[model samples]
Target: MARNKREEILDVALEMFAAHGYRGTSLDTIAHRVGLTRQGVLHYFPRKENLLTAILQCREEVNREHLQAGHAHEDLPGQMAAIVAHDHQLSGLTRVYGVLLGESITHGHPAQEYFRKHYATVRERMSASFAERWGDRLPSGLTPQAAATALLALLDGMQQQWLLDHTQTDQPEIIRDVLTVLLGSPPVK
Candidate 1:
Protein backbone atom coordinates (compact mmCIF):
# COMPACT_ATOMS: atom_id res chain seq x y z
CA MET A 1 0.00 0.00 0.00
CA ALA A 2 2.80 2.40 0.82
CA ARG A 3 4.58 1.68 -2.46
CA ASN A 4 1.32 2.07 -4.35
CA LYS A 5 0.78 5.44 -2.67
CA ARG A 6 4.21 6.60 -3.74
CA GLU A 7 3.47 5.54 -7.32
CA GLU A 8 0.16 7.36 -7.13
CA ILE A 9 1.90 10.51 -5.99
CA LEU A 10 4.35 10.21 -8.85
CA ASP A 11 1.49 9.84 -11.35
CA VAL A 12 -0.08 13.02 -10.02
CA ALA A 13 3.28 14.75 -10.13
CA LEU A 14 3.79 13.64 -13.74
CA GLU A 15 0.42 15.05 -14.73
CA MET A 16 0.97 18.31 -12.89
CA PHE A 17 4.49 18.66 -14.20
CA ALA A 18 3.21 18.07 -17.74
CA ALA A 19 0.37 20.59 -17.40
CA HIS A 20 2.64 23.11 -15.71
CA GLY A 21 6.39 23.09 -16.13
CA TYR A 22 8.49 21.85 -13.21
CA ARG A 23 9.06 25.35 -11.84
CA GLY A 24 5.36 26.07 -12.01
CA THR A 25 4.34 23.00 -10.03
CA SER A 26 4.59 22.96 -6.25
CA LEU A 27 4.65 20.24 -3.62
CA ASP A 28 1.43 21.70 -2.31
CA THR A 29 -0.31 21.13 -5.63
CA ILE A 30 0.80 17.51 -5.84
CA ALA A 31 -0.06 16.83 -2.25
CA HIS A 32 -3.45 18.42 -2.61
CA ARG A 33 -4.26 16.30 -5.64
CA VAL A 34 -3.11 13.16 -3.86
CA GLY A 35 -5.09 14.04 -0.72
CA LEU A 36 -1.93 14.29 1.32
CA THR A 37 -0.47 17.14 3.29
CA ARG A 38 2.77 18.75 2.18
CA GLN A 39 4.48 16.97 5.05
CA GLY A 40 3.06 13.68 3.90
CA VAL A 41 4.35 14.35 0.41
CA LEU A 42 7.75 15.14 1.89
CA HIS A 43 7.78 11.83 3.71
CA TYR A 44 8.03 10.15 0.31
CA PHE A 45 9.86 12.69 -1.87
CA PRO A 46 11.84 14.57 0.80
CA ARG A 47 12.08 17.46 -1.73
CA LYS A 48 10.24 18.58 -4.82
CA GLU A 49 13.37 18.05 -6.88
CA ASN A 50 13.60 14.51 -5.61
CA LEU A 51 10.08 13.94 -6.87
CA LEU A 52 11.06 15.36 -10.24
CA THR A 53 14.05 13.05 -10.35
CA ALA A 54 11.85 10.08 -9.59
CA ILE A 55 9.46 11.04 -12.37
CA LEU A 56 12.29 11.31 -14.87
CA GLN A 57 13.78 8.04 -13.66
CA CYS A 58 10.44 6.34 -14.14
CA ARG A 59 10.22 7.61 -17.70
CA GLU A 60 13.70 6.27 -18.47
CA GLU A 61 12.89 2.91 -16.99
CA VAL A 62 9.77 2.61 -19.10
CA ASN A 63 11.67 3.55 -22.24
CA ARG A 64 14.36 1.03 -21.40
CA GLU A 65 11.72 -1.66 -21.03
CA HIS A 66 10.37 -0.87 -24.47
CA LEU A 67 13.83 -1.05 -25.99
CA GLN A 68 14.74 -4.25 -24.17
CA ALA A 69 11.68 -6.02 -25.48
CA GLY A 70 13.75 -6.78 -28.61
CA HIS A 71 11.87 -4.21 -30.59
CA ALA A 72 15.09 -2.67 -31.79
CA HIS A 73 16.54 -6.06 -32.67
CA GLU A 74 13.55 -7.17 -34.68
CA ASP A 75 11.90 -4.88 -37.24
CA LEU A 76 13.27 -1.56 -36.03
CA PRO A 77 11.19 0.59 -38.32
CA GLY A 78 8.01 -1.16 -37.25
CA GLN A 79 9.02 -0.76 -33.62
CA MET A 80 9.80 2.91 -34.09
CA ALA A 81 6.45 3.49 -35.75
CA ALA A 82 4.74 1.63 -32.91
CA ILE A 83 6.50 3.90 -30.45
CA VAL A 84 5.07 6.92 -32.22
CA ALA A 85 1.62 5.38 -32.10
CA HIS A 86 2.06 4.69 -28.41
CA ASP A 87 3.06 8.30 -27.77
CA HIS A 88 -0.11 9.52 -29.44
CA GLN A 89 -2.08 8.16 -26.50
CA LEU A 90 0.32 9.49 -23.88
CA SER A 91 0.17 13.14 -24.79
CA GLY A 92 0.75 14.26 -21.23
CA LEU A 93 4.04 12.41 -20.91
CA THR A 94 5.07 13.64 -24.35
CA ARG A 95 4.32 17.22 -23.32
CA VAL A 96 6.35 16.78 -20.16
CA TYR A 97 9.19 15.36 -22.25
CA GLY A 98 9.15 18.24 -24.74
CA VAL A 99 8.79 20.96 -22.09
CA LEU A 100 11.52 19.56 -19.88
CA LEU A 101 13.78 18.84 -22.85
CA GLY A 102 13.49 22.45 -24.08
CA GLU A 103 14.11 23.74 -20.57
CA SER A 104 17.08 21.44 -20.02
CA ILE A 105 18.90 22.66 -23.15
CA THR A 106 20.06 25.70 -21.20
CA HIS A 107 23.10 25.57 -18.90
CA GLY A 108 22.78 24.45 -15.29
CA HIS A 109 19.31 22.96 -15.58
CA PRO A 110 18.70 20.19 -13.05
CA ALA A 111 17.83 17.68 -15.78
CA GLN A 112 20.72 18.59 -18.06
CA GLU A 113 22.96 15.68 -17.12
CA TYR A 114 20.07 13.24 -17.13
CA PHE A 115 18.95 14.36 -20.55
CA ARG A 116 22.50 14.21 -21.87
CA LYS A 117 23.07 10.64 -20.75
CA HIS A 118 19.58 9.61 -21.80
CA TYR A 119 20.02 10.95 -25.34
CA ALA A 120 23.44 9.36 -25.63
CA THR A 121 21.96 6.00 -24.78
CA VAL A 122 18.99 6.51 -27.08
CA ARG A 123 21.22 7.61 -29.94
CA GLU A 124 23.60 4.73 -29.43
CA ARG A 125 20.83 2.17 -29.57
CA MET A 126 19.10 3.86 -32.48
CA SER A 127 22.31 4.16 -34.46
CA ALA A 128 22.90 0.46 -33.97
CA SER A 129 19.40 -0.30 -35.19
CA PHE A 130 19.90 1.84 -38.26
CA ALA A 131 23.23 0.20 -38.99
CA GLU A 132 21.82 -3.27 -38.62
CA ARG A 133 18.90 -2.45 -40.87
CA TRP A 134 20.55 -0.27 -43.52
CA GLY A 135 24.15 -1.56 -43.40
CA ASP A 136 26.91 1.09 -43.55
CA ARG A 137 25.00 3.90 -45.18
CA LEU A 138 21.50 5.14 -45.90
CA PRO A 139 20.36 6.35 -49.31
CA SER A 140 21.04 9.95 -48.30
CA GLY A 141 24.78 9.16 -47.90
CA LEU A 142 24.52 9.57 -44.15
CA THR A 143 26.08 7.08 -41.78
CA PRO A 144 23.95 5.32 -39.20
CA GLN A 145 24.91 7.88 -36.58
CA ALA A 146 23.89 10.83 -38.70
CA ALA A 147 20.68 9.18 -39.75
CA ALA A 148 19.83 8.33 -36.16
CA THR A 149 20.40 11.93 -35.13
CA ALA A 150 18.20 13.17 -37.97
CA LEU A 151 15.49 10.68 -37.10
CA LEU A 152 15.50 11.85 -33.50
CA ALA A 153 15.28 15.45 -34.65
CA LEU A 154 12.39 14.59 -36.95
CA LEU A 155 10.49 12.79 -34.22
CA ASP A 156 10.88 15.68 -31.79
CA GLY A 157 9.86 18.21 -34.39
CA MET A 158 6.79 16.24 -35.35
CA GLN A 159 5.87 15.69 -31.71
CA GLN A 160 6.05 19.40 -30.92
CA GLN A 161 3.92 20.20 -33.94
CA TRP A 162 1.39 17.54 -33.09
CA LEU A 163 1.23 18.64 -29.49
CA LEU A 164 0.48 22.17 -30.54
CA ASP A 165 -2.38 21.06 -32.76
CA HIS A 166 -3.37 17.41 -32.55
CA THR A 167 -6.49 17.93 -34.63
CA GLN A 168 -4.56 19.41 -37.51
CA THR A 169 -1.61 17.05 -37.33
CA ASP A 170 -1.60 13.38 -38.27
CA GLN A 171 1.23 12.31 -35.96
CA PRO A 172 1.13 8.60 -36.77
CA GLU A 173 0.85 9.19 -40.52
CA ILE A 174 3.76 11.58 -40.50
CA ILE A 175 5.81 9.11 -38.49
CA ARG A 176 4.87 6.27 -40.81
CA ASP A 177 5.72 8.35 -43.86
CA VAL A 178 9.18 8.95 -42.48
CA LEU A 179 9.60 5.28 -41.72
CA THR A 180 8.63 4.51 -45.32
CA VAL A 181 11.85 6.14 -46.46
CA LEU A 182 13.86 3.81 -44.26
CA LEU A 183 11.92 0.58 -44.71
CA GLY A 184 10.46 0.90 -48.24
CA SER A 185 6.97 0.87 -46.73
CA PRO A 186 5.21 2.10 -43.67
CA PRO A 187 5.49 -0.24 -40.73
CA VAL A 188 2.45 -2.37 -40.24
CA LYS A 189 0.76 -2.66 -36.87
Candidate 2:
Protein backbone atom coordinates (compact mmCIF):
# COMPACT_ATOMS: atom_id res chain seq x y z
CA MET A 1 0.00 0.00 0.00
CA ALA A 2 2.77 2.41 0.92
CA ARG A 3 4.72 1.70 -2.26
CA ASN A 4 1.60 2.01 -4.37
CA LYS A 5 0.72 5.31 -2.77
CA ARG A 6 4.18 6.64 -3.41
CA GLU A 7 4.04 5.60 -7.04
CA GLU A 8 0.59 7.13 -7.32
CA ILE A 9 1.89 10.43 -6.01
CA LEU A 10 4.79 10.28 -8.48
CA ASP A 11 2.46 9.64 -11.42
CA VAL A 12 0.21 12.53 -10.46
CA ALA A 13 3.18 14.80 -9.81
CA LEU A 14 4.78 13.95 -13.15
CA GLU A 15 1.58 14.78 -15.04
CA MET A 16 1.23 18.07 -13.18
CA PHE A 17 4.88 18.88 -13.74
CA ALA A 18 4.50 18.12 -17.43
CA ALA A 19 1.48 20.36 -17.73
CA HIS A 20 2.60 23.24 -15.55
CA GLY A 21 6.35 22.85 -15.23
CA TYR A 22 8.26 22.36 -11.95
CA ARG A 23 7.95 25.99 -10.78
CA GLY A 24 4.29 26.09 -11.71
CA THR A 25 3.30 22.89 -9.89
CA SER A 26 3.05 22.83 -6.11
CA LEU A 27 3.19 20.14 -3.42
CA ASP A 28 -0.29 21.05 -2.18
CA THR A 29 -1.72 20.67 -5.68
CA ILE A 30 0.02 17.31 -6.11
CA ALA A 31 -1.21 16.11 -2.75
CA HIS A 32 -4.77 17.15 -3.50
CA ARG A 33 -4.66 15.30 -6.80
CA VAL A 34 -3.23 12.24 -5.08
CA GLY A 35 -5.93 12.32 -2.34
CA LEU A 36 -3.30 13.13 0.26
CA THR A 37 -2.84 16.06 2.56
CA ARG A 38 0.18 18.31 2.23
CA GLN A 39 1.73 16.62 5.21
CA GLY A 40 0.97 13.25 3.68
CA VAL A 41 2.92 14.25 0.61
CA LEU A 42 5.72 15.62 2.77
CA HIS A 43 5.93 12.33 4.60
CA TYR A 44 6.97 10.67 1.39
CA PHE A 45 9.05 13.53 0.00
CA PRO A 46 10.45 15.88 2.62
CA ARG A 47 11.05 18.63 0.10
CA LYS A 48 9.67 19.65 -3.29
CA GLU A 49 13.17 19.35 -4.70
CA ASN A 50 13.26 15.79 -3.49
CA LEU A 51 10.14 15.08 -5.54
CA LEU A 52 11.80 16.60 -8.58
CA THR A 53 14.87 14.46 -8.00
CA ALA A 54 12.74 11.35 -7.78
CA ILE A 55 10.89 12.20 -10.98
CA LEU A 56 14.12 12.80 -12.84
CA GLN A 57 15.56 9.57 -11.50
CA CYS A 58 12.44 7.73 -12.59
CA ARG A 59 12.71 9.19 -16.08
CA GLU A 60 16.37 8.15 -16.30
CA GLU A 61 15.47 4.65 -15.15
CA VAL A 62 12.82 4.42 -17.84
CA ASN A 63 15.32 5.50 -20.48
CA ARG A 64 17.89 3.06 -19.13
CA GLU A 65 15.36 0.25 -19.28
CA HIS A 66 14.60 0.99 -22.93
CA LEU A 67 18.31 1.09 -23.79
CA GLN A 68 19.03 -2.17 -22.01
CA ALA A 69 16.17 -3.91 -23.77
CA GLY A 70 18.19 -4.85 -26.87
CA HIS A 71 18.94 -1.24 -27.86
CA ALA A 72 22.39 -1.20 -26.25
CA HIS A 73 24.10 -3.37 -28.86
CA GLU A 74 23.04 -1.20 -31.81
CA ASP A 75 25.07 1.47 -33.53
CA LEU A 76 24.86 5.01 -32.14
CA PRO A 77 22.32 6.21 -34.70
CA GLY A 78 20.22 3.09 -34.31
CA GLN A 79 20.31 3.44 -30.52
CA MET A 80 19.28 7.09 -30.70
CA ALA A 81 16.46 6.34 -33.15
CA ALA A 82 15.20 3.62 -30.83
CA ILE A 83 15.24 6.04 -27.93
CA VAL A 84 13.26 8.65 -29.88
CA ALA A 85 10.73 6.01 -30.89
CA HIS A 86 10.37 5.02 -27.24
CA ASP A 87 9.94 8.66 -26.21
CA HIS A 88 7.24 9.14 -28.84
CA GLN A 89 5.19 6.52 -27.02
CA LEU A 90 5.72 8.14 -23.61
CA SER A 91 4.49 11.65 -24.38
CA GLY A 92 3.89 12.54 -20.74
CA LEU A 93 7.42 11.70 -19.65
CA THR A 94 8.81 13.50 -22.70
CA ARG A 95 6.81 16.59 -21.81
CA VAL A 96 8.01 16.52 -18.23
CA TYR A 97 11.60 16.10 -19.40
CA GLY A 98 11.28 19.01 -21.81
CA VAL A 99 9.66 21.22 -19.19
CA LEU A 100 12.23 20.42 -16.53
CA LEU A 101 15.09 20.74 -19.01
CA GLY A 102 13.96 24.19 -20.14
CA GLU A 103 13.35 25.38 -16.58
CA SER A 104 16.68 24.03 -15.37
CA ILE A 105 18.33 26.91 -17.21
CA THR A 106 17.01 29.48 -14.75
CA HIS A 107 19.28 30.78 -12.02
CA GLY A 108 19.63 28.44 -9.04
CA HIS A 109 17.11 25.93 -10.36
CA PRO A 110 17.29 22.64 -8.43
CA ALA A 111 17.73 20.61 -11.62
CA GLN A 112 20.47 22.81 -13.07
CA GLU A 113 23.32 20.85 -11.57
CA TYR A 114 21.69 17.58 -12.50
CA PHE A 115 21.29 18.64 -16.14
CA ARG A 116 24.87 19.86 -16.27
CA LYS A 117 26.25 16.61 -14.99
CA HIS A 118 23.91 14.59 -17.15
CA TYR A 119 24.86 16.36 -20.36
CA ALA A 120 28.56 16.08 -19.60
CA THR A 121 28.31 12.36 -18.93
CA VAL A 122 26.08 11.71 -21.95
CA ARG A 123 28.29 13.72 -24.29
CA GLU A 124 31.43 11.96 -23.10
CA ARG A 125 29.88 8.53 -23.44
CA MET A 126 28.40 9.38 -26.83
CA SER A 127 31.74 10.66 -28.07
CA ALA A 128 33.46 7.51 -26.91
CA SER A 129 30.86 5.41 -28.65
CA PHE A 130 31.30 7.35 -31.85
CA ALA A 131 35.07 6.93 -31.68
CA GLU A 132 34.70 3.21 -31.08
CA ARG A 133 32.50 2.85 -34.12
CA TRP A 134 34.30 5.17 -36.50
CA GLY A 135 37.79 5.84 -35.17
CA ASP A 136 38.77 9.50 -34.40
CA ARG A 137 36.20 11.08 -36.73
CA LEU A 138 32.83 10.18 -38.14
CA PRO A 139 32.42 9.49 -41.85
CA SER A 140 30.95 13.00 -42.10
CA GLY A 141 34.44 14.29 -41.27
CA LEU A 142 33.43 15.68 -37.85
CA THR A 143 35.38 14.67 -34.78
CA PRO A 144 33.66 12.19 -32.48
CA GLN A 145 33.08 14.85 -29.83
CA ALA A 146 31.64 17.33 -32.35
CA ALA A 147 29.40 14.69 -33.89
CA ALA A 148 28.17 13.70 -30.46
CA THR A 149 27.34 17.32 -29.63
CA ALA A 150 25.48 17.77 -32.92
CA LEU A 151 23.54 14.56 -32.40
CA LEU A 152 22.43 15.62 -28.94
CA ALA A 153 21.39 19.05 -30.19
CA LEU A 154 19.41 17.53 -33.05
CA LEU A 155 17.60 15.12 -30.74
CA ASP A 156 16.68 17.85 -28.27
CA GLY A 157 15.56 20.22 -31.01
CA MET A 158 13.45 17.55 -32.65
CA GLN A 159 11.77 16.69 -29.35
CA GLN A 160 10.96 20.33 -28.67
CA GLN A 161 9.53 20.77 -32.12
CA TRP A 162 7.50 17.61 -31.85
CA LEU A 163 6.17 18.66 -28.47
CA LEU A 164 4.89 21.93 -29.89
CA ASP A 165 3.41 20.25 -32.96
CA HIS A 166 3.08 16.49 -32.91
CA THR A 167 1.74 16.61 -36.45
CA GLN A 168 4.91 18.23 -37.74
CA THR A 169 6.94 15.13 -38.60
CA ASP A 170 7.74 11.56 -37.75
CA GLN A 171 10.50 11.94 -35.13
CA PRO A 172 12.16 8.54 -35.40
CA GLU A 173 12.31 8.68 -39.17
CA ILE A 174 13.66 12.21 -39.21
CA ILE A 175 16.27 11.29 -36.66
CA ARG A 176 17.36 8.30 -38.69
CA ASP A 177 17.58 10.41 -41.83
CA VAL A 178 19.55 13.27 -40.25
CA LEU A 179 21.76 10.81 -38.46
CA THR A 180 22.53 9.19 -41.80
CA VAL A 181 23.65 12.55 -43.11
CA LEU A 182 25.75 13.09 -40.01
CA LEU A 183 27.16 9.57 -39.98
CA GLY A 184 27.56 9.30 -43.77
CA SER A 185 25.47 6.11 -43.78
CA PRO A 186 21.99 4.88 -42.90
CA PRO A 187 21.44 3.57 -39.39
CA VAL A 188 21.55 -0.23 -39.13
CA LYS A 189 18.20 -1.84 -38.52
Candidate 3:
Protein backbone atom coordinates (compact mmCIF):
# COMPACT_ATOMS: atom_id res chain seq x y z
CA MET A 1 0.00 0.00 0.00
CA ALA A 2 2.78 2.39 0.84
CA ARG A 3 4.61 1.63 -2.37
CA ASN A 4 1.43 2.12 -4.37
CA LYS A 5 0.79 5.46 -2.71
CA ARG A 6 4.31 6.55 -3.44
CA GLU A 7 3.90 5.67 -7.09
CA GLU A 8 0.60 7.51 -7.23
CA ILE A 9 2.21 10.58 -5.77
CA LEU A 10 5.11 10.38 -8.17
CA ASP A 11 2.80 9.92 -11.14
CA VAL A 12 0.74 12.94 -10.20
CA ALA A 13 3.88 14.91 -9.56
CA LEU A 14 5.31 13.97 -12.95
CA GLU A 15 2.18 15.18 -14.69
CA MET A 16 2.18 18.43 -12.76
CA PHE A 17 5.87 19.03 -13.30
CA ALA A 18 5.66 18.25 -16.98
CA ALA A 19 2.75 20.60 -17.47
CA HIS A 20 3.81 23.44 -15.20
CA GLY A 21 7.59 22.93 -14.96
CA TYR A 22 9.49 22.70 -11.67
CA ARG A 23 9.23 26.26 -10.35
CA GLY A 24 5.70 26.61 -11.65
CA THR A 25 4.51 23.39 -9.99
CA SER A 26 3.56 23.49 -6.33
CA LEU A 27 3.14 20.86 -3.64
CA ASP A 28 -0.51 21.79 -3.31
CA THR A 29 -1.05 21.17 -7.00
CA ILE A 30 0.51 17.73 -6.72
CA ALA A 31 -1.46 16.86 -3.61
CA HIS A 32 -4.70 17.96 -5.14
CA ARG A 33 -4.06 15.94 -8.28
CA VAL A 34 -3.28 12.84 -6.21
CA GLY A 35 -6.21 13.31 -3.86
CA LEU A 36 -3.87 13.63 -0.91
CA THR A 37 -3.46 16.27 1.78
CA ARG A 38 -0.29 18.31 1.79
CA GLN A 39 0.89 16.43 4.86
CA GLY A 40 0.15 13.14 3.15
CA VAL A 41 2.27 14.16 0.22
CA LEU A 42 4.97 15.22 2.63
CA HIS A 43 4.96 11.75 4.11
CA TYR A 44 6.20 10.45 0.78
CA PHE A 45 8.39 13.40 -0.21
CA PRO A 46 9.38 15.75 2.57
CA ARG A 47 9.98 18.64 0.20
CA LYS A 48 9.47 19.65 -3.42
CA GLU A 49 13.20 19.15 -4.04
CA ASN A 50 12.88 15.60 -2.82
CA LEU A 51 10.10 15.02 -5.31
CA LEU A 52 12.26 16.44 -8.13
CA THR A 53 15.09 14.13 -7.14
CA ALA A 54 12.73 11.17 -7.17
CA ILE A 55 11.52 12.12 -10.60
CA LEU A 56 15.10 12.30 -11.91
CA GLN A 57 15.87 8.92 -10.35
CA CYS A 58 12.79 7.45 -11.99
CA ARG A 59 13.90 8.81 -15.38
CA GLU A 60 17.39 7.36 -14.90
CA GLU A 61 15.92 3.96 -14.13
CA VAL A 62 13.72 4.16 -17.21
CA ASN A 63 16.66 5.12 -19.45
CA ARG A 64 18.87 2.39 -18.00
CA GLU A 65 16.15 -0.20 -18.56
CA HIS A 66 15.64 0.83 -22.15
CA LEU A 67 19.38 0.97 -22.89
CA GLN A 68 19.98 -2.42 -21.29
CA ALA A 69 17.17 -3.96 -23.29
CA GLY A 70 18.50 -2.46 -26.48
CA HIS A 71 22.05 -3.62 -25.74
CA ALA A 72 20.88 -7.18 -25.15
CA HIS A 73 20.18 -7.55 -28.84
CA GLU A 74 23.24 -8.18 -31.02
CA ASP A 75 21.90 -6.36 -34.07
CA LEU A 76 22.86 -2.69 -33.91
CA PRO A 77 20.14 -1.45 -36.19
CA GLY A 78 17.55 -3.34 -34.21
CA GLN A 79 18.94 -1.75 -31.06
CA MET A 80 18.68 1.71 -32.54
CA ALA A 81 15.13 1.01 -33.64
CA ALA A 82 14.23 -0.11 -30.14
CA ILE A 83 15.70 3.11 -28.72
CA VAL A 84 13.73 5.25 -31.15
CA ALA A 85 10.54 3.38 -30.32
CA HIS A 86 11.15 3.76 -26.62
CA ASP A 87 11.70 7.50 -27.04
CA HIS A 88 8.41 7.77 -28.91
CA GLN A 89 6.69 6.01 -26.03
CA LEU A 90 8.12 8.35 -23.42
CA SER A 91 8.29 11.66 -25.25
CA GLY A 92 6.55 13.55 -22.47
CA LEU A 93 9.14 12.61 -19.87
CA THR A 94 11.84 13.23 -22.44
CA ARG A 95 10.59 16.76 -22.92
CA VAL A 96 10.43 17.23 -19.18
CA TYR A 97 14.04 16.16 -18.79
CA GLY A 98 15.16 18.40 -21.61
CA VAL A 99 13.45 21.36 -19.98
CA LEU A 100 14.86 20.58 -16.56
CA LEU A 101 18.34 19.95 -17.91
CA GLY A 102 18.28 23.33 -19.59
CA GLU A 103 17.10 24.92 -16.39
CA SER A 104 19.69 23.06 -14.34
CA ILE A 105 22.43 25.25 -15.82
CA THR A 106 21.50 27.63 -13.00
CA HIS A 107 23.55 26.99 -9.86
CA GLY A 108 22.17 24.71 -7.12
CA HIS A 109 19.19 23.32 -9.02
CA PRO A 110 18.13 20.05 -7.41
CA ALA A 111 18.55 18.19 -10.68
CA GLN A 112 22.02 19.46 -11.62
CA GLU A 113 23.86 16.51 -10.16
CA TYR A 114 21.37 14.08 -11.63
CA PHE A 115 21.71 15.54 -15.11
CA ARG A 116 25.49 15.57 -14.89
CA LYS A 117 25.66 11.94 -13.83
CA HIS A 118 23.06 10.99 -16.40
CA TYR A 119 25.02 12.58 -19.24
CA ALA A 120 28.26 10.99 -18.11
CA THR A 121 26.67 7.54 -18.00
CA VAL A 122 25.06 8.08 -21.39
CA ARG A 123 28.34 9.13 -22.94
CA GLU A 124 30.18 6.17 -21.48
CA ARG A 125 27.59 3.67 -22.62
CA MET A 126 27.35 5.17 -26.07
CA SER A 127 31.15 5.25 -26.38
CA ALA A 128 31.42 1.59 -25.48
CA SER A 129 28.76 0.72 -28.04
CA PHE A 130 30.48 2.70 -30.76
CA ALA A 131 33.78 1.02 -29.99
CA GLU A 132 32.19 -2.39 -30.08
CA ARG A 133 30.50 -1.75 -33.42
CA TRP A 134 33.11 0.20 -35.32
CA GLY A 135 36.42 -0.11 -33.60
CA ASP A 136 38.08 -1.93 -36.48
CA ARG A 137 36.99 0.46 -39.21
CA LEU A 138 37.28 3.75 -37.33
CA PRO A 139 39.61 6.23 -39.02
CA SER A 140 43.18 6.29 -37.70
CA GLY A 141 42.72 9.71 -36.07
CA LEU A 142 39.26 9.08 -34.56
CA THR A 143 38.59 7.85 -31.02
CA PRO A 144 35.55 5.97 -29.77
CA GLN A 145 34.96 8.52 -27.01
CA ALA A 146 34.86 11.31 -29.54
CA ALA A 147 32.52 9.37 -31.77
CA ALA A 148 30.25 8.56 -28.84
CA THR A 149 30.07 12.18 -27.72
CA ALA A 150 29.17 13.24 -31.23
CA LEU A 151 26.52 10.52 -31.54
CA LEU A 152 24.88 11.46 -28.24
CA ALA A 153 24.92 15.11 -29.22
CA LEU A 154 23.35 14.23 -32.54
CA LEU A 155 20.62 12.22 -30.87
CA ASP A 156 19.91 14.99 -28.37
CA GLY A 157 19.62 17.56 -31.14
CA MET A 158 17.44 15.26 -33.22
CA GLN A 159 15.15 14.59 -30.27
CA GLN A 160 14.72 18.32 -29.70
CA GLN A 161 13.80 18.73 -33.34
CA TRP A 162 11.35 15.85 -33.25
CA LEU A 163 9.71 17.16 -30.11
CA LEU A 164 9.20 20.51 -31.80
CA ASP A 165 7.69 19.01 -34.96
CA HIS A 166 6.58 15.44 -34.44
CA THR A 167 5.03 15.24 -37.90
CA GLN A 168 7.53 17.17 -39.94
CA THR A 169 9.52 14.01 -40.61
CA ASP A 170 10.16 10.49 -39.39
CA GLN A 171 12.73 10.58 -36.59
CA PRO A 172 13.63 6.90 -36.55
CA GLU A 173 14.29 6.92 -40.27
CA ILE A 174 16.36 10.04 -40.00
CA ILE A 175 18.36 8.56 -37.15
CA ARG A 176 18.86 5.30 -39.01
CA ASP A 177 20.07 7.13 -42.10
CA VAL A 178 22.47 9.35 -40.23
CA LEU A 179 23.85 6.42 -38.25
CA THR A 180 24.22 4.36 -41.40
CA VAL A 181 26.37 7.06 -42.95
CA LEU A 182 28.47 7.36 -39.81
CA LEU A 183 28.87 3.60 -39.43
CA GLY A 184 29.33 2.95 -43.13
CA SER A 185 26.31 0.70 -43.30
CA PRO A 186 23.12 0.74 -45.37
CA PRO A 187 19.83 1.92 -43.94
CA VAL A 188 17.90 -0.61 -41.86
CA LYS A 189 14.95 -0.94 -44.23
lDDT of 1 by residue, 1-189 (tens): 899999899889888888888877889989999999999999998988887788787766766676677566645455666677667777777778888888787767788898889789988998997788778886556788987787788778888887888884466666766766754433454
Give all candidates' CA lDDT scores. Answer: 0.77, 0.89, 0.75
Task: In candidate 3, list every pair of residues with a backbone clash.
Answer: none
Model number with the top TM-score: 2
Candidate 3 structure, TM-score to reference:
0.82
TM-score of 1: 0.82
The TM-scores of all predictions, comma-separated, are 0.82, 0.93, 0.82
Off by over 4 Å in 2: 186-189
Ten contiguous residues minimizing lDDT sum, candidate 1: 180-189
Top candidate (lDDT): 2
Candidate 3: how many backbone clashes?
0
**In terms of lDDT, which candidate is stronger, 1 or 2?**
2
Query: Any residue pairs clashing in model 1, and if so which?
Result: none
Write down the worst ten-residue block by lDDT for model 2: 180-189
Show model 1 residue runs off by greater than 4 Å. 63-74, 132-135, 182-189
